[model samples]
Target: MERSLLTRTMARVPGPVTVVTTLDADGKPWGFTASSFSSVSLDPPLVSVCLDKGASTHAAFTTARHFLINVLAEEQHTVARRFATSGIDRFAAGDMETCELGLPGLHHTSVRVACSMHSIVDAGDHSILIGRVEEAFTSDRTPLVYYNRSFARPASNPDRAEQDIRASHIADW
Candidate 1:
């Protein structure tokens, strides 16, 4: 299958925007925006997020003992873009606060999952970090969605809903 074709097909399937955060050995926070996050199990409470092997924070996350997954709210699209950009101070915005499990997390998110590293699986050009859920936080806010390479929100009233795809400047990771 063609890579562009596969990318376009997957883009049509909306995904929740999340920023996965972890601290380096020096205790400095590092993170990357990801839409490839999912629940893997419930018995031992496992969740997984895919990190591009080329991501700037890839090394930090792959070696970290714990991490946090912040499911961004609809209004937090900017935060997602900031984290996704390479060669910039993703944490300079100071929007993150120390939260559950003492990991940096974005407040007012739709959900936050704190996890301890369980296992790492090599998958093609990415590494799948499967984590054991240590704690979770949730709010009633609507989660931000990434669809068709744009930021979106679920329509509250489909009948009268208009397409609201905000063009995003985030580069593909």
Candidate 2:
């Protein structure tokens, strides 16, 4: 199978946009936008995020003791784009704060998970970093989503009830 074909197929699968942040050894914050985050375990409360091997922030994150995953809200598309771009000062984009774990976190996100680095696994062209959730926070905002190479949000209609929307189109997958 061609890599491009596989990528295109995966693009159809929607995923929550996230900004994973960590501080380097010198206390300089580093972060990157990702849509490849997922919950791995519930017993120990673990989650995983994958970063491209060539990403500028990869080394810093792989070596960091802790990190925070800020699940972007629909209104935070700019935040997602900023972190995804290369060669930009992501932290300077603003709306960031220090979490209890001392990792940088985005403000007003749908959710924030502060985690301790548990394991790093080398995959084909990326590295998967698994973290043990130490603390988490959630807000009532709608989560930012990525699909077909663009940002998206869950449909909302004033006349349609939440349960109606879910029953009509939302799938467990």
- Tell me each candidate's TM-score: 0.89, 0.90
Counting clashing residue pairs in each candidate, in order, gives 0, 0
After superposition, which runs of candidate 2 have C-alpha atoms over 4 Å from their true positions? 156-173
Q: What is the lDDT of candidate 1?
A: 0.93
Model 1 residue-pair collision total? 0
Model 1: pairs clashing at backbone N, Cα or C within 3 Å = none
**Superposition error at 112 for model 1 (Å):** 0.2
Q: By TM-score, how accurate is candidate 2?
A: 0.90
lDDT of 2 at 75: 91
lDDT of every model, 2 decimals: 0.93, 0.93
lDDT for predicted candidate 2 compared with the true structure: 0.93
- What shift in Å separates residue 97 of candidate 1 from its native position after superposition? 0.6
Off by over 4 Å in 1: 157-173
The sequence of per-residue lDDT tens digits that candidate 2 reaches over residues 1-173 is 99899989999999999999999999999999999999999998999999999999989999999999999999999999999999889888567988748888976899999999999999999999999999999999999999999999977787678777777776655
* Candidate 1: tens digits of C-alpha lDDT, residues 64-148: 9999999999999999999989999999988899999999998899999999999999999999999999999999999999999
